[model samples]
Target chain A: MWDEKETDRKLCIICSKGTLDMAYPGLVLANAALMEGIDVTIFFTFWGLDMITKREMSNLKFTPIGNPHKMNFGNRTIGIPNAVAGFPGMTNMATSMIKKEMDKLEFPEIPEFLEMITDAGGKLYACRLSTDMFQLHEEDLYEGVEGIVGATDFMELSEDAQIIFI
Target chain B: MTSREIAGKTIEFDEDGFLANPQDWDKDVAQELAHEVGIDELTASHWQVIEFSRSDFDERGEAPTLRRLKVAAGVPTKDLYELFPKKPAKKIAYVSGLGKPHGCI
Candidate 1:
């Protein structure tokens, strides 16, 4: 009932957040969309580029400040209030806990997920403005990153796609 | 739980018509369910998706989301749409007797 047209077949996901937790939604969604045989392109801008950066990619840190507590301890999924996230060493604890839980589920690590997305035929692009502002070179990006693109390029490319911002 | 009678069997379903108990599902049920959703006949390719969906649901204790199905079922989005039409993910989950996957579906 949302629209008379057939379901959208192409998806454009924008990733602007850089935290480890913030990265999964875009990555997992892109992975899922590609699997469904939908064409997917992910635009990583601002801090999001850290996800695809060869130097700082794999060990991206989780910032407990203003982070939502997933409340997952061990294998149990819980929800902790955001207020508690401000305590000392909370970011470290949260990161370790989340990594452990993700590992238990056999989900690929961030680097592996990026590779999987590219291998699965999804496209990855870094924002040109962000790259230039940050002084990052193409050599600083991981393999399979389609060159840095500007806002206009992304909008034109995604004109026919269902846009998702994360 | 709601229900629809298919092939003389009373199969329970959730609000969106996905089979409440996936075990209530069978080939006859799948074919009948497909018809209810506007698929007049189930083709070999359609059966491929249903079989994969059901097996994956059984193995994972969860319905394979479109992403999981892409890897495990080996069917692309284009063909899935051609087979099941609009909202293919939800339709396939219903036709294949699995719960609705979480998200916009």
Candidate 2:
């Protein structure tokens, strides 16, 4: 009597980059699903696992190294050869603006968000391979993290659930 | 591809940089919604809201309404008052595709 396609179960696999924006969607989606009366799980992998780690999670930064988003939109829009945007301060400006906007929304900081996930019924798992590569231990993750899991385990959970690679 | 198709559901740019299907929303969804509309390129601070919004949901289990967002996001309402100068937070959230818009989600 269970319809797989119509099932409300969802799974989110978050591969967080150092970019905080990149990291937030996965957590938000996962918690949202849970709140909606759907079952949810989250798998943190790659740079995303940094959120669970101690030394690097809070210190996450956006480096200028090879960042394609910083390219000038006008050049791309007009078919120019990699012409950078006229506004040199665009990046900094956008960053500051969003930060202010977020502050108004009363969004929690990273550490508190981790606690929110645990307090919610959602499950948090760190990627075993990514953890090993990063030399992270269980202590590096937030308290609610279930454990380190491999891709196979991740896929198995995602089989019927919606999988989001954040 | 069309705006109508994305009416109610939240559409976000995922870690992969594609138009992502957030599938669900929390407080972070609001900021992500803002990111979707305001700027094409998001800075670290922009992403910080995304993280915080999600975290807010992780703790609270639901997206904060307008008033809560004002407090949780940490920006003085006056600060945002100056930034948009014209648009209200609800409009900003709506344009950003934060909650169930009108049809999709």
Candidate 3:
């Protein structure tokens, strides 16, 4: 029902975590918004920058340690008792299980989904502060990344957009 | 019991104008339905989306979500968004002569 480009709705997503669980929430919502014709921009900062950095993209892991939600089986979950999270190899086991399930479902890997979203016109913004602090070069980021932008620039770009912190 | 005349055929529609029987839809009917929904013309690309949506409904027995369109129908998100704009699921359902979307209104 939108008639004008100037009036097009925009969604600005802030990804502050690099965990696989956190990454999907933002990417899925961003893709859904783009499918609905809403302009979308994802700003990655701190650990979130790990999601876009080429060297770290495939390494986004699921950490069961300290997570209140436990590993779920088909019907039930082995809710992590905080103490049990410290057991040797528990986090790695959980991560492997999640990856297996993702593979079974044929979900595109993190890098592929990021490319998909960008190909669909969703803009990916890397935080300049995070880049400088982490010593990340522009070449180290994914091909989809539009640029390294500061908080001020992001705010200006998102002035008319709904900001979603994920 | 509302009905619309499309391509010289009397087509039944629900009160909300969704096709009462989606099987009655054809490409010609789609062009007319598209216009009723404010889509002035149906390009080949538009037909791709509409056809994909209708075929998906036929196979799935429900309106296809925009997410499914991207994943299964192979319609790029940029194309889907540009073709249907805000709320592609509902708009595509309307133009494709399918029922209203069950999710996300």
Candidate 4:
């Protein structure tokens, strides 16, 4: 019986570590899995928790403060490490250019895509510790969020299922 | 309760906002969709976009590039933003079926 359960079990887990580029992959994967009729569960930890919370989700900004992928524009031709790429202002400029290019293509902003996942019956959860660390509350999360859960609780639900940390 | 053509049975939505549907998805995903959006049953506009996009992709043998889709859809650039603000354009085109999903384009 245990073996049978294990064979049929499948789970998708995403741990969003907060690189602007990294955030979307988790969401996209979760949504795609749900469409395939697979049982999916998302566990948000640390900076990843922000995406599920409402106040943070809508106002997310790429921090150029120390981001290493930032482009130094005029100096980009020289290809310096993004960590030393100009200053915060320059980082903002690069991020803006990226946003504009994305805009032209009709990519839905982060929050919109989250809504799509929710509408499609995907389940979302927030980590209690992460929310506490960030000083967030259950009410702060996006509309479709299931609830706050700890690691043990999450693992139990994901027992015998495939776990992916995105 | 009986099956009948209710006034609010279906909805018609376009760039401006929701219209002709009694169901209120406004608080959720529907609000996020700003470009000719439709749900719970297809509308004429939805059919047009789907049909035109499919045909366009079939003829070109490639997804209709963003510029071309905008012109064909008859909406401002901001409209697309409202429709799909998160995923990339290629994924949007595929999801929207503005291009055929299974390799048509």
- The DockQ scores of all candidates, in the order shown, are 0.12, 0.04, 0.33, 0.03
Q: What would the DockQ be for model 2? A: 0.04
Please report the TM-score between candidate 4 and the true structure.
0.57
- Preferred candidate (DockQ higher): 1 or 3: 3
What tens digits encode model 2's per-residue C-alpha lDDT throughout B25-90? 444544444444444454464444445544554576543443354455764433433332223332
lDDT of 4 by residue, A44-130 (tens): 889888777776675455545555443544555323355655665755655566566556655556776666556544578888888
Misplaced by over 4 Å in model 2 are: A1-7, A63-97, B1-105
Error of 4 at B26 (Å): 35
Q: Which of 2 and 3 is the better model by TM-score?
A: 3
Q: What is candidate 1's lDDT per residue for A1-166, written digit by digit as tens?
A: 0112344599999999888888988998887775456889999999999999998888877765664656656588655467776778877877787787776655667887887677666799999999999999899998889889999999988988999999
| Candidate 4, pairs of clashing residues | A107-B84, A107-B85, A108-B84, A108-B85, A108-B86, A109-B85, A109-B86
Supply candidate 3's per-residue lDDT for A3: 25
Q: Deviation in angstroms for A24 in model 3?
A: 1.3
**TM-score for the A chain of candidate 3:** 0.89
B1-105, model 1: which lDDT tens digit per residue? 776678889888776556889888889988887877788999999998888888887787876655455556778655776787645677788788888776321
Q: Which residue pairs overlap in candidate 1's backbone?
A: A37-B77
In order, what fnat does every candidate score?
A: 0.03, 0.03, 0.31, 0.00
Ranking by DockQ: 3, 1, 2, 4
lDDT of 4 by residue, B1-105 (tens): 112221333334332221222232222222233232223443454444544555675676555543345556664334433443332233334333332232210
A49 Cα displacement, candidate 2 (Å): 1.0
Stretches off by above 4 angstroms in model 3 are A1-7, A70-74, A99-107, B1-3, B9-20, B37-44, B65-75, B79-89, B101-105
Give the docking tier of candidate 4: incorrect
